[model samples]
Target: MTMTMTMTIAGACPGFRARLLLGGALLAGSALAGPAVAQDMPAPQKDAAPGLTKVASFEHQVTGVTVSKDGRIFVNFPRWTEDTAVSVAELKDGTLTPFPDAEWNGWRNAKKDQVDARNHWVCVQSVVADPKGNLWVLDPAAPAMAAVVKDGPKLVEIDLKTNKPARTIAFDETVAPQVSYLNDVRFSPDGKTAYLTDSGASGALVVVDLDSGKARRLLDGDPTTMPDKSVTVSYDGKPLRRPDGRGVEFAADGLALSPDGKTLYWQAIKGKTLYSLPTDALTGWLTSAVVPSALTDKSLSGKVETVGENGPADGLIISRHDGRMYVTAPEENAVKVRDLTAKGGTPTVLVQDPRLRWPDTFAEAPDGTILFTTSHIQDSAFYKPDAPAALPTELWSIKPGAAEATGSTTAPK
Candidate 1:
């Protein structure tokens, strides 16, 4: 078998594929994904331990951050607090400057207006610049996580050089706007389409056809995409609850497309379980009768939760080199890795830091440096409006070799 296939299988089923099935039987119907006994998974090799050194931090509250192909960093400042302003900025020479110098407002297409002091986009939650150097702006424009607005939920495409939006795709009530807090996005390997996570009340996976400007929402409110009730996430050892006492939580936040672009893995912000589905099943452009069954492959039905499996995980990364996936767990103040080659290896803790507050997003540098954000969002005023604010939110980076060498990387299942 080719290395890719061999690794995919190995990564998914370490040495105890059959044992994992037996384990699954114990939790039948619910779902169980594993290679063998969680304890039996071999301990990963430890040689060169890489550590997360504090690189750069933001003066104001940080929302989302994305690293460019050339290593330029872009971040979003949402209007979460009452008086604070909303804007997108770039990190240059260690200074945060207004990107394209525009304040947060409503969005418009490239043909509409240029970004200047007067006219700008608003309420951007996440920012991702694609491989082709196009910046994608995800706006979920309500005060905090409340999905009260309709016209403002949009995905704006901005040209890097001009800082002008080339296109603006708006979400309306028909598309369940209130339920669509558009979160993160990942481009297909070919860059022909982009998959966005609707982390709003009604969890969904939104797929956009870049060329046609057509968009579709699938797996809408599906249980797999939603966080289970029994799962309670404790940030920094503190239970995370909603400000309204209504159980504040997330359905999906961290998202990524596999290197081969065949599957999309995602997990809820407040959820402990991780789920994935075939990308082709989600594209929704094809009309084959067997498409439904293809979308529900039994192999893909297993639930991959790292609640107790891995540390409190966030920010997942899939290394193309070995088809292994990595996750950041701020609760444990660590980063973990699982080899898909073993199919179900136990997770290993690669990096841990008591100071790494709520490590959020992941970005890959050209030379394999893994970039991630540490927002300490749980400690923010948004979560505890009455508490004092923690300044100096940081963005961090570490190499895979460094992560594995240290106990930060998790073992395969």
Candidate 2:
């Protein structure tokens, strides 16, 4: 069976006007952009940490950020609202330049089997750098969060030495289904395998065998990967909802891997629970002919385990030095650090900053400084048509008082 889906713009969609009016009335006094300032907007809330500083700002919404071993910064802005002139950019000397070249950043419309699509970034959701200094760009090719074009979703690897694309790994429907929104990814220590979260229609973990360029979708529709419908997201004391009256419900968003490459951690954006599983269980299933029923069967011992979290979380990272898991709790406007080795200990606030509107991703620099991006997605035009003009997305960095550690050099999951 084959299926295709696409999402229309806000005004073009049916009943959008009515939805917009209702949304505007509900969000009447909410402050999204703050005073329509010509200069940089003031911090929504102050950072509790003293060392936090701004690295760069973008007019477009930036969801993912990663730093290379040499301290080179790269960020990705997904094509969620208006088409972005450049989806992926490199931050240098306080300015962003289209990565590699502008041609690769150019993607206008969805084309079926377009060869050039591999070169262009189509709705790139995340940017990550590997341990070997190679940058990987994951493009779900689902513009406006709609249906994906045929042969559009892919992972492009770029060699930093040459600043050119080293190879492209295209994903078929089996790996990235029509409704699949490839969210974030983390690589194995050896850089041989990558695990990604599908936060869209069908939530699952996608395991990619880099050597063979084969990708497999695992644990599809499993309880751990699905969103808990009962959980409601409250941003700034109000229920975070879209113009259509639907709350933000993303599933299986953040992902992380243990330093030893033994365990993988993941959680849904709309959920308060966190989960982990043995890496071997995922890779081992890839080689087995296990049916869907058997794979999702809870009775099948040695499956994933739940690691309960504080609240709705976005980005997740396990510190290589101490094995502490750092999670971004947007509801609390704080980052929570959990000791994975502890048996049911409460998460401690690593950094609580009112400026963190929607802390999305994390990238630990070689010097032990942690970098993250804030998109303020809850205030995006998709949810609030009357939202003030888009504010510049921010990139921030702070040192968590930890020495440099060894592990995969991927972006925040």
Candidate 3:
């Protein structure tokens, strides 16, 4: 298979397929997004790595980030430790604006009983700019990883041209149970289906048909999706845990699709091993006429291929520029690249800096710069009650191939 279609990580492995599942990626964008305004960047975290540049800093916990094909930059703030003012925003030329408008972001935790969580951005986890020129948002609607509000969980698609929601697919208790937190999503190249990861109490992959608006939750509680009990997440050279003695337990979080869309890979944030499966295996069962059964689910599970290890990662993306998979190595304060030329191999550090505290999510610009966020999970109130409710987080970028750091700019308004 060609590099465009397959990201073969190693030589021959136990389950490496002869005809690997791979697909095309999004169209390349034009230039590197402009830097955040100078005042927005605190001097302490500036130029923390060789080619790393600080783009923007936010008051709330910032998790997911995406660079649109036409060069628009968007980010998301999940209502994890505090009630976020704006759940999703656009970063343009130095200003960060509530995308679409403020009305969509007006939902508040204080007014949860009064407000309708169905239409508003409630605990948005990811913002993805699809190849079809639409921006999609995934909202688990479970604030602080707690109870899910009735009619809260949803996936929304907005047309970039009109800046209005084109369609929305709602997930009920069956698809997004109270314990599931839909984390991230990758759209198929054809724009017909979407794949997502549930990184909550029990882990699973949620597949949605864009046209039918039908969703199927697969691999629920499977070993590959759940957090590995043997793994321990540590930060600052110590095991990160709350006073009650809980280590990182997020499951099936980081997700990546092959450049060609034939392959899909994901791993748990509280676990290390990466796993992948052919898009065909997932979509094939989803579209079939027979009702979903345990036998069918087990058959699909057997098709999953172990893609080797990436120690405690949070986000993942296959770079359209170099065709290598980039992983957010949160525990290591680094970003890594898994060379796809090999069959099934290990990833090497691409960028590492102390400032990259929990490099959470990734989005590659057309110019090939990799932009990620430092969510600072270890410092959040969930782990440390003494921490400020409104946490300060920053957006960072890794210039392809270690170029001179782009000079800083003004902060977003």
Candidate 4:
């Protein structure tokens, strides 16, 4: 696995000595209360029972999931609202085992005990595997939205074989001091560049030069980058608002690089519009004067089509063989697909079940079966109640048939 560490943080661990990596930001508010309801998925498929084979499940709530090039599944659990012993694990031989033990996880959680700062691992927003087979773990470093600009907020890269870190990326007071909860990251097809989304308090795209190890935020709060206010996102049945009065807009959660590697598409959790830009325009290396002449009128750069108007939007993946884009729209209790090439047909509805309570991430297997996770988030203490849930959160899979494929094929990256 490839490990990356650029900016240095005082308490940050150099590598992955354990399974869990914890980050906490202290914001004022009462600590969230206890055991959430056992949330359940919607009813099974009606016709053929759209076979949903469970790959794995964890006792702690799972937020993000990803698969390595070799097909090994890596999952991360942020030590956020819940009291947790471990933060990350791997599914091997159909069983979940700690990829790294607690010592490593504890180091991730440690913070200054000074009266002004509180220590805790808030949550892990993204888990991604690079082309070189290294796993990149993004730790938002701040717990609960308390702004910790210095000695906090980092990205840790771990070697899958040794479970050790190759590098750590951090920011201090000189950099933007507010919380930079680094979210999803995607590698260029050539693997020469990496683009990360900052879904933190300051929403922006942080572009990193992999070869040079340089990083900076771009489209910083630009109109195209900000979230739209008209869209309301619900998890199960309730809207997901920050504990504070501010509504959760510009979540900047779901990210995808087009098959050609020229366009980067993104959507906010609280946004209804889908926006994209030429990769060259968002790198921050070019000033408006030097920006490509082709990069003008972002609204004309891409069109934002309406997906179902419900629930929060999370992970997104584009199929290599069929040119279809799959997204998780958890409010409607379903996983939806849009044919990128369709001229005017309605987007096909893939799976919409109550069981998919709060589906977060989406990954397509080599064979075209879509894999995703269900958090039952709307039913959780963070969003809803603390009682026995009627349904269980599960990992679900759906296989696409030959008819799903169009006449064209995606060129190899």
Q: Using TM-score, give the best candidate's number.
A: 3
Worst 10 residues of 4 by lDDT: 29-38
Writing each residue's lDDT as its tens digit, candidate 3 over 1-413 gives 11212221122112211111111111122223334221222233332555666666666688989977766778888989887667887764334567777778878788643478878888999999898868999999999989887898999998888999988899998789999899999999889989999999989998889999998888888889999999999998899999789888999999999978999999999898999999988898677886555213678789999889898999999988789898888888888889767867789877777777789999977677787888999999878979988787878777757533433222212
Q: Model 1, 1-413: lDDT tens per residue?
A: 10100111121112211111112222322211122212121122233134544445455556677766555567776655532333576654323446655344333323254233223544567888787877787776654666435456677787876867788777665443665677778888787888887677777777778877667666666666666677777764567765875554677777877898987888776676667777876674433333223123343244333322443455776865556677877666667777655544456766766656788777665455666777777777767767554344666666567555554533222
Q: Which portions of model 4 miss their true places by more than 4 Å?
A: 1-51, 108-122, 145-150, 172-177, 235-247, 284-312, 342-346, 385-392, 402-413
lDDT per residue for candidate 4 within 24-63, as digits (tens), equals: 1101111111111011112222332254434444455676
TM-score of each model, in listed order: 0.74, 0.82, 0.86, 0.72
- lDDT score for candidate 4 against the true structure: 0.55
Worst 10 residues of 3 by lDDT: 17-26
Return whichever of 2 and 4 wins on lDDT: 2
- The number of the candidate with the highest lDDT is 3
Model 2 spans > 4 angstroms off = 1-48, 109-115, 289-302, 388-391, 402-413
Best first by TM-score, ranked: 3, 2, 1, 4
